[model samples]
Target: MKIVKAEDFDLRREVEYGSPEQNEAVREIVAQVKQQGDAALLKYTEQFDRVHLTAGQLRVTEEELAAAYQQVEPSFVEAIAAAAANIRAFHSRQKRNSWMDLQPDGSLLGQIIRPLKRVGVYVPGGKAAYPSSVLMNVIPAQVAGVPEIVMVTPPSTGGTEGIDPYILVAAAEAGVSEIYRVGGAQAIAALAYGTESMAPVDKICGPGNIYVALAKREVYGVVDIDSIAGPSEIAVLADDSADPAYVAADLLSQAEHDEMASAILVTPSPAFAEACRAEVQRQLGELPRRGIAEASVRDYGAIILVDSVVEGIDVINRLAPEHFELIVEEPMAYLGLIENAGAIFLGPYSSEPVGDYFAGPNHIIPTNGTARFSSPVDVDDFIKKSSLIYYSKESLLSNGATIMELARREGLEGHARAIEIRLRKEGKAGEAE
Candidate 1:
């Protein structure tokens, strides 16, 4: 790892940027899916995944799930069940109820909250299967009262590295009604447009490769999608009191995700920077994804030594990291200053992985610099709201003329006439004679 002062503009810029090819490819994939539906999906599946899945095989059977459960150990199955309960408990608090209010003037106004009729969740099975992701995606929709939830993953790669049995166990625990043995862009297309076997979903959530991101972009209007996720990243704002080894390990946790991933340490202590750089090397030797982590650190990692912890925090807000860990002496002191982060890990004990698995919070977070405006996945993603309004004769009479005048001012004669017609029906306004 290389150390740079916070004043190094070029290095700072590179750390925050991402490649744009994913966006363009996503546009193309979405179009093909919308136009051809399942046919295009099957073609892509065969090309990308090297497997052919007929419509009937698209939905995983209960018998297959039971076999999957039998393949995993009892202890692992119990852990997934416990994790599901925690996830469900946290998300249930986010449920919104439909409400209506009566006004003094005999008007009724409010909004209705309704769950999406159906949803599709994409779980990546290529590099690793995320059973935790299965829990994170399905539990929220269940909490929102969504009637149907379906899941999809690439067929097992014929190795333990392919799709972990834990992922299947987790999905079953989370109440996913349907599972698919397909993945990549084709799976995303199937979810958005629906094949003969796959039902069309109102919204699609979860994570995948660049092809999947492009596919989701292509099918966005055809079906709602979660934000286009980028490579993983974590920014740690630490001081001299922070542990260099823990910081290095935490940063590498995300760095190992991909070469494009970023892990930055912003601190006031140059000594801390030196120690962390050495610690990264020490830990890299032991990491299973050493090549991936090494490349990520060599290209995008940074040790930004600032003048003060306040300046370190400022740089973090500027980066708008996907995950922010505060390891200062009093980490909570800067909590309010954190304006842009998908999640904040306070104190040394709260590692980023906690939120990824056992923690109650959803792990599907905004990536790149999107934390500036977007938020993490939650129950809100699976629900829709409809605004309600009702007016008494008197309330309409009071506001109708202003509404008509405004509409006419905008050169919308039809809109103005609509209001005028309403008022005339009540004998409160005159028609053009």
Candidate 2:
């Protein structure tokens, strides 16, 4: 990994995530799916995922779902069930009830919270299997009372046999039945624009490769998306008191994700930076995904030297990483100083993987500098809100002329007339200026 001063570090490296050709490819996929429906979906699935399927074979069947349980071990099943329980318990706290408020003007004003009727969750299945993503994406929708949650994952090989057993088992545990064996930008297109075999969903959520990310970006306005997720990133802000081995291990965890993934360390102590960098090089030799991790760390990863812990916090906020680990002497004392991390790990014990798997928080976090504006996937992602306004005759009569005046100020005669007609009927056209 490269070691540099804070002034030499570039924030722009993480900001620009993908290429234009990737965006254009996603656009073509979305356009074709919208035009040809199942035909285009199946064709692209074959081209991208190497899986060819008929209309009937596009969707996973009940028999396949049942066989998934038999293929997976009992212990694995129990573990997912437990994880689901924790995920459910945490998201249940975010549940919102439709509420009403009675105003002094005798008007009923409130907000109605309603879950999307159906949602689609994309779980990456080609190079890796993230069953944890299934639990993260579907559980919140279930908590929000989403009636139907459909899941899509690319088939493992060119053959259209079935999905990864662990993924199926996780989907089953999370109460997602409508699953399709498709992936890449094609699967995203299929979800955003319904094919003959599938129905269009209200919202789509999950993470994927660059193709998947670009597809979500293309189809954003047509259907709601959680966020334009980027490559996985982690930043560790540590001091001399922190563990070099632990910090190295944590940094390598994200580094192994992909070549584009970023793993950075910021510290004031020069000795600690050298120790951690050496530890990372040593550990990288032992990892199975060493080549990927090595490339990520060598390319995007860095160890930045700051003047102090306060200066480290300034750099963290400037970069706004998706995951942050604070390994200073008093992690909590500097908690208020951090302003831009998607998820913060306060102490040495709180590793990033803990939140990725067993912890209650959703692991589908905003990436890149997006943490400055966006948030992690939660119950709010699966539900929609409607502002409720029941203006009584008295309230309207008293405020109608004021509204008309404002509308007229904007030169919107139609809007002013709409309010004027009701005020005149109520015999209060001249009321409230």
lDDT of 1 by residue, 1-433 (tens): 8899988834333332225775665566666766777676666667666667666666677877777788899999888888888888888888888999998889999999999999999999867668899989998998898999999898764421134567778888887758887787778877877767778899999888877777776678888998788889899999999999999999999999888898999999999999999999999999999999999999889899899989888888889889999999988888988898999999999999988888798888998788889999999999999999998887888788888888888999999888888888888755321
**TM-score on alpha carbons, each prediction:** 0.93, 0.96
lDDT of 2 by residue, 281-392 (tens): 9999999999999999999999999999999999999999999999989899999888999999989999999999888899999887888988888998888899999999
Pairs of residues clashing in candidate 1: 26-214, 30-218
Relative to the unseen true structure, what is the C-alpha lDDT of residue 42 in candidate 2, on a scale of 0 to 100? 79
Overall lDDT per candidate, in order of appearance: 0.84, 0.90
- Worst ten in a row by lDDT for model 1: 9-18
lDDT of 1: 0.84
Clash pairs of candidate 2? none
Off by over 4 Å in 2: 14-18, 429-433
> When superposed on Cα atoms, how far off is each prediction in RMSD?
2.7, 1.6
Question: Model 2 reaches what TM-score against the true structure?
Answer: 0.96
Who wins the TM-score comparison?
A: 2
